[model samples]
Target: MKIILSTLNAKYVHHALALRYLSKSVPDARVMAFTINHTVESVCAELYKKITTDTLLGFSVYIWNVEMTLRVLARLKKVAPQLKILLGGPEVSYDPFETLTANTFVDYVIYGEGENTFKALCNANDCVSLHSIEGLAFRQDGQVIVNPPRPLIQDLDTIPSPYTSAELAAFEGKMLYYETSRGCPFTCSYCLSSTTHGVRFFSLDRVLADLRAMLDHRVGQVKFVDRTFNCSNVRTKAIVTFLIQNAAQTNFHFEIAAHLMDDALLALLKSAPTGLFQLEIGVQSTHAKTIQAIHRQTDFEKIATHVKALRQADNMHLHLDVIAGLPYEDYEAFQKTFNDVYALKPHALQLGFLKLLKGAAIRDFEGYTYCDCAPYEVLATPWLTHAQLLALKRMEDMVE
Candidate 1:
């Protein structure tokens, strides 16, 4: 099969990390990544001209690209009915009921961890029954059949290297992301990281090797995709120590729960050079009950103290996040939460509204109304009415 993986990225400099991973997962796969700013007609025209009967096009569906992807997909199915269209990635991975049935164009969906499953599905022969493929969901004879789930890859080193591939050199200067870990230690209901608990690490040797390759290639800042980059203090320290010891011109970004920062990480951060490390702290909601309702544990005192300490040290640039419309956080309460986080004087402060992601705790959650779209943003809840949410959005606009 002539397999190709693609997605419409939010911008030109932003490459789709999942698309690269999918392409790296299957050696035979080619990639066609584009930006969403372009019209669907232009993109579809270019893509439709290249489709061959033997081709299998797989899209790394995400919130930003789903609408655009569907538009192109509908046109592709009309123009080349014989071509196969495969869907994967977070947007379609969990509950594809709507995507599979509502859109007859999608031929197959490889749910969960897609690397191994996609390789296996592509290798399967036409004569093989759909039921035989694990982690696959398909429509057959007007009924959708979903295969048994595939567990997350315990050994992540098996996911091939996109850094070492010559084809990826074209993406230089476009921000790149590397995953050193998977899953999260905390169960924050509002986030998808809650789905997979515990932490899994890629071999330190493998990670260090990839970093060396990235640095040698002079690739720009590499952001670690690990949910909680500092979840394991020992592992985090080891990696930090290595980066400090083997100084490179490359900058690294991490999303760390600031409360988890230990004295060791603090000491390291105190002395690290400016712009070497950038940390993003998620202070979702400051209301005690709101935090508890989301099943997140945090020490605001420590977070503030450490964040201030780091800010004072002038070592790393800090970005902090706040979510509006969390449970128990009314408009007034949300303003308080915003004020609390905003007071930190972070280099960058993010104001994001709650999104009831398909598989997140808020999806079928009671007393909540969310947008009926790919992103499924929370419109309102028992705690906050739609008008209040809109007010909060306007407040967010003021600061952001």
Candidate 2:
């Protein structure tokens, strides 16, 4: 059986780390990554040439590229009806039945962590074997049957590091996504990570070894996909310390909770070379009520203090994020949020609109409506009107 793992990245500089993990599990699988810039006709044409009778094509879907991916697959299926297509990633994981119902050409959907499930699918010779695989969803007798969710991988070390000497060389001078952990400590209602519980970490030894490989190859930048890089102070410090001691031209980026920073961590960061570290802090809203409504835990005062401290260093890049259209946050409240975060003088301030993503807790809240499409950006709410959100979108353009 021939397996091909693919995804349309948001940009040419971005690579799909999820595809790499799945490919590692199924060593025979080939990875074909593309960017959203590619036209659907062109991508489908390229993929169609690789399909055969026994080939299985897997797509790692995201809000940014779900439509384009579906278009490409829809065309490919018309040309090769025997071709098997599998869908995974957060976009389809939560609501597999709906995805399958709408796109009958897609043969399977892996709802959760996909390594074990994907490998099982690759090894399965017939329909009976697929039914036994946990975390799998497939059509049986004209109805989508979503199997029970798979247990989270406890020994993360078992998931082989996707990086190899040759792969590292290929990834040089581009943004690479790496992960030392999975899940998040906080349950932010707007985020899909909130649906899962607890944070899982790969062994420190495993993480350091991977980082060492990237540094050795002189990769340009590595972005940690961990939901909260500072969830564990010890782990954060250890990783930071390692990066500092093994300083290189390679830059590392992490999405961290600013309030989690302490005097010791700040001091450790200050000692690192200038521009070696970049931190992105998400302060979705400054309003206490808004934060509570979203089930997000944050202390803006502490966050402000830490952000100011980090700014004072004048070494690393600091990017702050604030979301408009959050619950109970009217235009005036959002203005306060923007102004509050702006006053900190972050190197970059991102103004984002709320996205009621599928499977996110925010969808359960009443008095809110979002677009019924990919990205599902907020349309209107009791607090913010569509016109106000549009104005915010213009403001975001100017801010960028």
Candidate 3:
């Protein structure tokens, strides 16, 4: 059987770690990655024509690529109806039955962390065998069958890096993704991280070795996919100290909570070699009501102080983020949020609009309306009018 793993990334420079993990789990299968913005049509055409009837194509779905992937799946089915299609990731995991029944082209969906489930699925003999695989959702005799959820991988280290020589060769001048840990400790309402229960760490030894390997290969950049890198101070310091001690040429980036930074953490980061570390901190909003509404915690004063302190080092590149169209954050309020984040003189200011993702708390809450698209971005809220939201979007574009 020819099993092919595919995904549509947000950009050409971005690489999806989920695809890599699934590929690593099934070493024999080939991986085909594509970007969402440009060449999507051409890519769909190419895959539809090149794939044979015997091929089994699996797509990694995301809020950004759900529509594009569906389009591709539809076209591919018309060309090769015998081809089997599989879907996975957080987007499909929430409503697998509806997705499977609504789209006949999708043969199956392996929800959640798919490394183990996907491995079992690829080895299945027939449709009957597919029923035995745990954590799967499929259609059997015109009825959708949703199997029990798969347990999270207790030992994250068991899943090896997807960085085979052939895989690494494909990302030559592109970005690389590394996960030092899984799950986030915080329960931010708008984030999917809340669904995850506990934090699990990869062995520090394994992480150091992986870091060394990436440094040896000298990839463009390695971005840690961990939701919150500094959630655990011990692990954070260990990893940071290793990077500082190793002192390689490759750049490492992480998304961390700025308010969580203590003097010790700041001291550790302040001494890093210039260009070795880049940090992205999500300061979603400055308004207290919005922050509380979204269940997001931030010590603005502490964050400002820590951020400014790190900037003096001239080594750390801090990227501060602000979200527009959030609860109780009107245009004027978002303007204040933007101005507040801007005052920090961050290397980059990421102005993001609120996306009411599936399973996020905002979806269950009231007072918001959003587009019914893949990235269900907020169209308007009681606090922020549609015109105000559009104005903020324009300002964000200009700021970027």
Candidate 4:
């Protein structure tokens, strides 16, 4: 069996890791993974030229984007009808019903965590009892069936490293990406990370081992995909200290909760090697009402102080984010947020429009208006009109 797992771009490194873990559980399954640059059409054309029709037996294709999945499925059906297409990740998982029912191209949709479900599907000869499979959705007997959710993977150390030493070598002296944990502790309405109510950490020993492996591969830089790297101060300190001790080899980056930082963590980060660490802090908005509405409660003063401290250290590269189209934030309010976050002088200021993803609290609110397009992103809320959304989008482009 041959399985191909892919990302829309190089940025979605975590998806590759998850698929790699799934690939390990299936014996004799040759996995071919690639990062598609732009459109699905381009990707399929390239695949058609590379892979011949005779080679598509017991093959599985997994993709992140709906359009990409559909395009690949259409081509595969015409050329190799036996190939199975499995859809997962945030883009497809957001609205599996519409994606499954509307598009006949997708054979199965893996909801929530995909590692176990993917492994099961790969190893099974017949998928009739798909309902018995946890964390999966598929069409059975002309009806769409959704299985019960699976428990989160508690033992992160049990999973093998996604990249082999040789595979990691491809990224040597280039961009490196890895994840230290699975879920997020915060409940920010606009984020998919909030779907998981709490945090889960990988084994400290396993993490250190992965770091050592990356170092051996001569990986120049590593980015941690954890939503909030500092949710556990003890774990955060341990990882930071380990990196600092081995600063000559690995330079790690993290996305953190700025307001959650205390004096102890700051002291450690302050002394860490310069150019060895980076932090991305999500300051979604500065307005109190907007913060409350979005269910993100943080002390702005504390965040400001902590950011200032990190910036003063001249060691950590800082990045801040703000969203323009929140429930209660008006244009003026958004301006204030931009100015306040920009004042921190972050290396990059990411201004994003609100996206009402599936299973998010904001999606339940009937007060918001949405765009009807391929992406199906949110347009505006009752608090902000459609025109304001256009303005914000333009502003974001200009600022970014």
Candidate 5:
């Protein structure tokens, strides 16, 4: 048997990690992975030609894009009729039943976490009892069957590190990526990271081992993907101290909760070398009503002060973000957010529009209405109008 896991990740290094882990659990499974962005269709066709009858067997395709899933499935089916397809991730987990029923190409839908369920499906000898598998959805007797969800992985250290020495060696002096945690503690309504609803950190010793492995492989830069790297001040300080101790060999970056910073964190950050670290702070909006409406609690004044202090230190690069089309944020309100975040004068300002995904709080609210279009993004709200959204998008383009 053979299996293929594909993703639309911007980088090949991270995509290979998911593929490598899946391959390790499935015996004799020839696993091939591809990374495509805005080019899945053409890339799938190219890969189809490389597989012949002898090399091809039962295979599966993973869809992360709901908009492109049907089109890509149709293309893949024509190339390989025996291939089985699975849909998972945030895009499919939101509404699995409708997606599975509508698309004939998808054989199964894995909800929530996929690491264990994927291993089970690959090793199953009979497909009849597949419905008994937890965290999976499939069709049987013209009905959709959904199984119970698997518990979240508690011991993160047991999982193998995503980067390999050979892979890290490829980018000897360029880029490195690592994730120290799985989920976030905040409840920002617009973000999927908030859905997980708690903080889970990897073992400090395991994290140090991974960092040492990357450094030994000569990786110059490392980026932490934790949603809020500084949620636990103690852990944050320890990691920063580790980095500072190894500053001569590695440059580390983090995405942090700006309002959560304190004098202690500020002092440690100030002592780090310039260009050795970077911070990305997400200040979605400054308006109190807008912030409350989106279930995001932030102190704009304190955040501004902290950003100013970081800038004054002249040690690390800073990036800030703001979102348009959030509920209660009108054109004028968004302009204020833009001005406030921009005035901090970080390296860049990321102006984003609202995306309504499954399980988001704003999605359940009837007060705001969305456009019935392909992208399915929020079109208007009681406080924001359609015309205002279009105008604001234009302004965002101009400013960003």
Candidate 6:
């Protein structure tokens, strides 16, 4: 029962689209994806030369590779003590029994949205079919058993396309993650998509036949992982007027909500073409009490009048973001939220620093202080200090 699927990616052109939707519902699962620049003894000596002891292996954890995927599954279960770990996204899907009681060599996790609980746990074989697999979380006699969560998959075109044609030749120069949508009309309390609630969609003829099969494999970039991708202005002008009428050189990143732009989607993204669209937005703090203490529903003057009308229509690629230590932001109110997002002249600005993740809603807010592990960042807050978050990390290293 091999079933492998993995993830570590923080670079090398990033690709694990949820291990290609859990390898299209476990069709003899085997994915592998690695990146946090490898080491953990070279990814457990290449997964101990392709696993055994009845394999299982799954991973896909987050918060930038959950502490190197728990030190590469605690050194691959101390060199394969009958191999069979497992864990799933959103950093162990919000505490699956405190992630199997502090990772006892994680024998299972598969919380929310893991393609029908990892294809009913690779077609379960015993323990009374793992107690009827519903977003499982394992261990028994020594108790852990999390079950009962697997709901959110309302026919997202019955989850399939991980772009076949042998996965678009393993997506040549990487960057090709696409998703027509999935929950986030706005809950924004330092997002984990605000502990999931609404939005779903996948049919606009299954998103223009999955962007006409990644613009007929011209795939240089696609990146829509939809946290908001314009939260539906008729599917953002029919997917940006079908990627400006069938994207020629691909290029298409998203993450939008710039006060929900319009004026006919900024005149169809000011008639695209110059580096065909990029966007990104997230102005995390212009400090109206740190955007009402992070329930962030922005309007920063209509995001500075639609990022100064898409930077004077210099043809797309905006990128703005902010975040430095929230809840009434300090250090002189984050320098006026970084000079009001650096006077919106963004072609890219970022400067982020607040992380407090693991089931976010601002980690139940109250005088912050973080880094208890895997990117729980903040480190000082009764109105910011830790030497002003190390002088906002040396002003984010001189604004990169």
Separate clash counts for every candidate: 0, 0, 0, 0, 0, 1
Question: Judged by lDDT, which candidate is best?
Answer: 2
Q: How high is each candidate's TM-score? A: 0.96, 0.98, 0.96, 0.90, 0.89, 0.36
lDDT of each: 0.84, 0.92, 0.86, 0.74, 0.74, 0.84
Model 5, stretches more than 4 Å misplaced?
A: 10-21, 24-41, 50-64, 141-143, 371-375
Q: Give candidate 4's root-mean-square deviation (CA, Å).
A: 3.0
**Tens-digit per-residue lDDT, 162-233, candidate 2:** 887899998777779999999999999999999999999999999999999999999999999999999998
> What lDDT is reached at residue 144 by model 4?
79
Cα misplacement distance, residue 389 of candidate 2 (Å): 1.4
Error of 2 at 347 (Å): 0.4
lDDT of 3 by residue, 1-400 (tens): 8888899888877877888888888887787888887565787776776588588899999998898889888988887889989999888888788889889888899887899999998888888887888899987777889888889999988998768666665655567998988898888888998888889999999888887777667677889989999988778998899889988667889999988877888999999999999999999888999888888777898889988998899797889898887888887888898899899999999989889888888887788899987689999898888898888878888879
Q: Write the per-residue lDDT of candidate 6 for residues 1-400, one digit (tens) a residue.
A: 8878888899978788888877887788988888998898998899889998799898888898888889888988998989988888897888899989988888888788888888888888897898889889899778888878877888889898777866776665457888888889888787898788889888889788877877776778889888988877867898888888876887889989888887888878888888888888888787787787677777889888988988898887888888888887778878987898897779779798888888888889887889898788988988887997997898888877
State model 6's lDDT. 0.84
Per-residue alpha-carbon lDDT of model 4 for 1-400, expressed as tens digits? Answer: 5555544544434335565666665544455554544566666665555454333222222332545556666776676565566777777676677768987756777777777777777666666656678888877777777778878888877766767777788877766668889898888877778877777778899889988888788787788878888989988899888888887755777888888987999999999888888888889899999899888968889999999888888887888888777878887888899999999888888988776666678877777777554344667777777887787788778777
- Comparing 2 with 3 on lDDT, the higher-scoring candidate is 2
Query: Ten-residue segment with the worst summed lDDT in candidate 2?
Result: 170-179
Cα-based lDDT at residue 259, candidate 5: 90
lDDT of 1 at 266: 91
| TM match of model 6 to true structure | 0.36
